[model samples]
Target: MPARTVPQVRRWNCPPVTRENVDWAQLATIDLARARTPEGRAEQVEIARDAMHKQGFFYVVNHGFDLAENQRMIDIASVAFEEVDDEEKARYQARIKETGTYLGYKLPQYWVIANGVRDRITHYNFPRNVHDRNHPEALRPYLPEIQEMVEFTHCTILHEVQKLLSLGLELPENTLSDMHPFDDTNHSFWRFMLYDPRSEEEERKTEGVWMKGHADHMSFTALWSQPVTALQIKDHDGQWRYVKHVENAVIINCGDFTEYLTGGYYKSAVHRVIKPPADQEGYRRLNLIYFGYTSDNVVLRPLLESPVIQRTGLTKVIEGEHPTMEKWRKTRTAVYGVSELKKAADGSEYEIVNGVKVTHHH
Candidate 1:
């Protein structure tokens, strides 16, 4: 008997974004170098704090990743998807690993808690880690161009995140550089290529591929979504407001990991993507390549950085600002994940979401 051949079927084809759709000339990005200056960086730290506190999503322009590289990764993924067989595709379905890492790719996960809803998009999910290192999930070489692009993106964002964490905690730069950039021991990343709808269906059904309003799992997420109009974020009033897409922009959002780390001045906002009222043909949303943190390690601790804020003015705000870091954390934690995490003193054994044991040693 011969081995069965896996099917290779692809039904998605959309044009690379053009001027008529998105006004890219008007889009702007925060200067990376300016953000590095002491005063400017301080303002950005505050901006980060306030952005999370005010809006769940922030539009970032001028990130260092080469625009050509970004587009190249997208093209690479699109080509790869078309080239792979069905069995190869099936390898990506979500499954648990003994090493506390999820190595498989999965479609848009349809959970029961989706407010009686499910999304209409599919994706290629992969966990991230250092290459050739001893990890629960080993990251071997796949697509060179995509790997390089993602690495550059990850390093750039990680550097910025380290700065934000330090500024939030009032720690010296040297103090943080001593520790690993992001702890891969227990920390993980879920980066994937997402496919948005082509056009809205006449009758929207529950079985198609799409994105629903849900908060990410990391404290911060750096995403490069294809220029499309489907992504949306929830307002303080809980309305799903549109997030206008811009080329060369990476949308940053707060997530559960940060909600846990910040202990609450920041926010992880709820967001989604789907068919809008105007376009009935469905579109593909390409989350070209981005990264997020895992749930096992980072702690949600309220940072009291400002010497004055910590010692004197937590209860005394100039305006309607968050009273204390703890208060902010509680608020974000509520939105990110209501379930609590219990860890052992030595930072090893801990209780997971379902009260199951998840042990990892430092």
Candidate 2:
């Protein structure tokens, strides 16, 4: 009798957490007041340091970005995604499913270096405020309204980031006083609009890995996950903890450059996406914009010299400052495309910042 009714299994399955289900302290990134003062900013940086150095991850509340702007970006993202024609959507379905991650429009299975985990999603990339206008490739041009919003978000974040850097290191205001917004390449931000549109065929794939566990290759990542439960962060216990999209708050995690800078004092957090449950089928991840930065030169090794770090074997390495603008043009493919290195199949290449896998589906 039981043989008459075996049901089908789906590709992705994840649990959701309502406000009633969360452990607020476990998810708290900082003390709210410290989030406001430079000293408080320094403490958050210390958390970034602690997270990077020991835990390899931390939640951040109020590091200094405009929450209203972030929420607006989210609104715009939904419009752009829903506007795609069926043909474009179909073309992307395969690739987005292949990487099982939302790297871009359409990607091949092996396009990403992290090939064994959740990869189902979409990404809407936005250009840097100053760099976009001057970028030779920026002429492709998005819609006027879209471009304006993106530019606004990009510049606003950059200002906040600079302030964070100054506060994190306890530097004097304008310590990077000489830095320019459009210096070309040393610092750049890219935003992606990601979502998951579950089609029935996706329910039938065998041994499917939705999105693989990986690290952001840039210095730091500021992400506003679409209030969905798929985004998970690896905790100190090696357990994947779901990062709830807190309303009006952005999540900041350490990235490659951020880690290498403190001589490993700060760590590049590892993360991945998990599929949502079947009953919740057809759920979509709205928009997640990541402000990604690249040093002008790949070799600007982070100098690890904090007093605590100096107490250890870690000393300081003053690698030359990066070249700034030319760096982006040459390294664009590596940053935006999937990893090309041999270890790609095993995800090793995906972990490398400069020498990461390079695929060209975007």
Candidate 3:
């Protein structure tokens, strides 16, 4: 049988709606269906590559995944989060803040960045190919539906994104794909997020910021079109602009891993969530995100031989050998304001922010 054609997307041009001095630029959109043929694939690569260089983020459309199915999973997650008793949730609380382990559930407002209130976000993470022993019992019953979503996104969306990136980098077609082959070893995780709307009093205390600025440790992060608009990304001008959500589109952003691989040509954009608009203030927000990491066995280093890498006059300072996905996560957990007691691989414990460890107590 002939290979099926990928879905195609027409370029969309529209300015993002903005408020409060935040410039929301219209992000370029690429259609994944354009990637099935060699000629179309080349065009997609250029589009994706340009977006990476300019903003390190873009909206992907025409990806052959059911938006309704994604919403269905989110609905199920909502029930699991709201209906589940607090006692059961406590059992599955994330160990990252304490033990530096990245698994299970993280209660709301568990991360306190700066001298502000704890973030108004609760989340759960599901790793690809979960180990038998580490699986959380709380999510066992819902695993079937949840796992389907995770695998489909990985195979259909993330996989193609990586291929385009590799092509744009002027590397062998399989350079990045080879590093992240379709298998159990790929260190990807799906995050289910619930953002509680801020009340009048609580919004005043927050001073407009809901979640603090930070960068992801993975190669890239794909966020589904969410119902509310609170996410923002820092541009090259150092200004924070709302990452406007496009209908039926998935927002993709580079992370530190991509930065290291490209020798800083591709940067990891810092982003945060701010207080919702007055109309959306009382409504809860649900977001589905996938953080795709390089395969565990792939050692991260700059692809120095690529012509783009050479022409960009990029330095090799940040291009040296870097930790694999597992090590990076552990390192991130250690310093992500989890605990002053947390230590890195070198046995040094340090907290960037003092007196503001995020705890479950509200």
Error of 3 at 304 (Å): 0.8
Instruction: Put down candidate 2 lDDT per residue, 265-358, tens digits, no spaces.
Output: 5556777665554443456666555555543554445433345445554342324453232342335334343534334443334322333233
User: Candidates sorted by lDDT, descending order?
Assistant: 3, 1, 2
Q: What is the alpha-carbon lDDT for the whole of candidate 3?
A: 0.70
Worst 10 residues of 1 by lDDT: 353-362
TM-score of each: 0.66, 0.65, 0.83
Per-model CA lDDT versus the true structure? 0.48, 0.47, 0.70
For model 1, residues 297-337, the per-residue Cα lDDT tens digits are 32334445544235433321122222332233233323222
Score residue 220 of candidate 2 by CA lDDT. 58
**On TM-score, who's better, 1 or 3?**
3
Best-to-worst order by TM-score is 3, 1, 2
**TM-score result, candidate 1:** 0.66
How many Å off is the CA of 342 in candidate 3?
A: 16
